[model samples]
Structure formats: C-alpha cells, structure tokens
Target: MDMEERVVGEVLVVRPVGKRIDASGSADFKGKMVDRINRGRNLIVLDLSDVDFIDSSGLGAIVSMLKTLGKKGELRIGGLKETVDSLFRLTRMDRVFRIHPSAEEAVLALAAAKSMAKAPA
Candidate 1:
C-alpha cells in the first residue's frame, strides 16, 4: 500500500497510490490510517483517484477508520472512480460519508466548516 499524506489547512489529505484496495492492501491501509489518527491527525480526506477497484475489506477498513475517528474527527472521501462510487452508493456508505468530487473541494469544505465553528456567534 502506497499512500501520500499532506496537510491542507487542518485537513489531512491521504492519497493511496494503488489500483486496488482489496484484501491484500486493506490491512496496510487501515494500519497507516490508524497510525495517523494515533498521531493526532484528525480531519481526513481520502483521495481515491488512483484507486480503480475496491473490495469489501477495503470498504470495511474505511468504515473502521470512521468509527475510530468517532466524535473527535471527520473523515471525508474524494476522487472516487465510477466503480468505487457505485459501490459506496450501493452499500449506502455514500450517505455515511461526505463524498466530494475532488480533494481540493473536500479540503476547502472542511476548512470552511472549521472556520465557521471557530467564528464568533
């Protein structure tokens, strides 16, 4: 599992540079995410542009990450390929997460939300 991590104004952008996230890569993906979370990086935007295929294990790993984040953080996904997007929609995971058209949009949206939360009422 190859992943690139970058911080975009409080949102951690994680781009997995792989064609598939199946049983073989799920554990590595989950471990890397957990390590980041344990390191105190909360808000995340998973960029799946390079990922063309995913299996149940990959989906499960993502859900697990969301659960681990819980109330302390947010997990948004972006750049999903058509097949991956269909899977998320079919599994109703799309409703469970904020799916963005692009990573830039995801990061900007999260940043805006953060700014709004900190604004004086």
Candidate 2:
C-alpha cells in the first residue's frame, strides 16, 4: 500500500492511495503507523478517502495503532467511504475512533481539541 503524507500544522495527514486495506496490506499499514508514532508523529489524521474496502485485519491493525498511541497521541479517522463507514458502524469501531469528513476537518478538530485542553478552566 502506497501512502502519501503531509503536515497540517502539527498534525500529520496520511492518505493511503489504495482501494483496499485487507490482510495483505494491513501489516504494512500497521508497521508504517507504528514507525510514525515511534518517531514522534503524535497528532495524526488517517485519510481514507481512497479506501473503499477494509477487512477485519485492517480494522484490527487500526485498533492496534490506536493502542500504540495510548495516552500519548491520537489517531483520527477521516474521509471514510460508504462501505468502510458502514463497516465501522457495524463493528462499533466508529465510536472508538474520532471520525471526520475530511483530513482538513480532522486537523482543525484536533487543533481545537488541543487548544481546549490547554485552556485555563
């Protein structure tokens, strides 16, 4: 799976340029995400606009990425296609992830959340 990466402020937007993230590609996807997280890419937005299909392996890989970021970083999902979105909903993974309509929207949302976190109560 080929991935394109860009930075929006402190957020890294990773767009996988493939249609499927199945068992074949899930390991690569998970490895790359882990590498990024280990290298300090904490604020991340996974843009899935091009991905229309994903299987259990893919979903598990994503969940692993979230666990890898536990209490230290965030993994936001964005631009989910209809089928993928449905899968997330069916599996209740939608509730586990902070889903956004687009990568830009995710970036903005993350920025807002960070600011709110830092705000004086």
Model 2 misplacement above 4 A: none
Q: How well does model 1 score by local distance difference test? A: 0.92
- For candidate 1, lDDT tens digit of each residue in 62-98? 9989998999999988899888999998999888999
The Cα local distance difference test for each model comes to 0.92, 0.92
**Pairs clashing within candidate 2:** none
What's the lDDT for residue 82 in model 2? 82
Residue pairs whose backbone atoms clash in candidate 1: none
Best candidate (score: lDDT): 2
TM-score of 1: 0.97
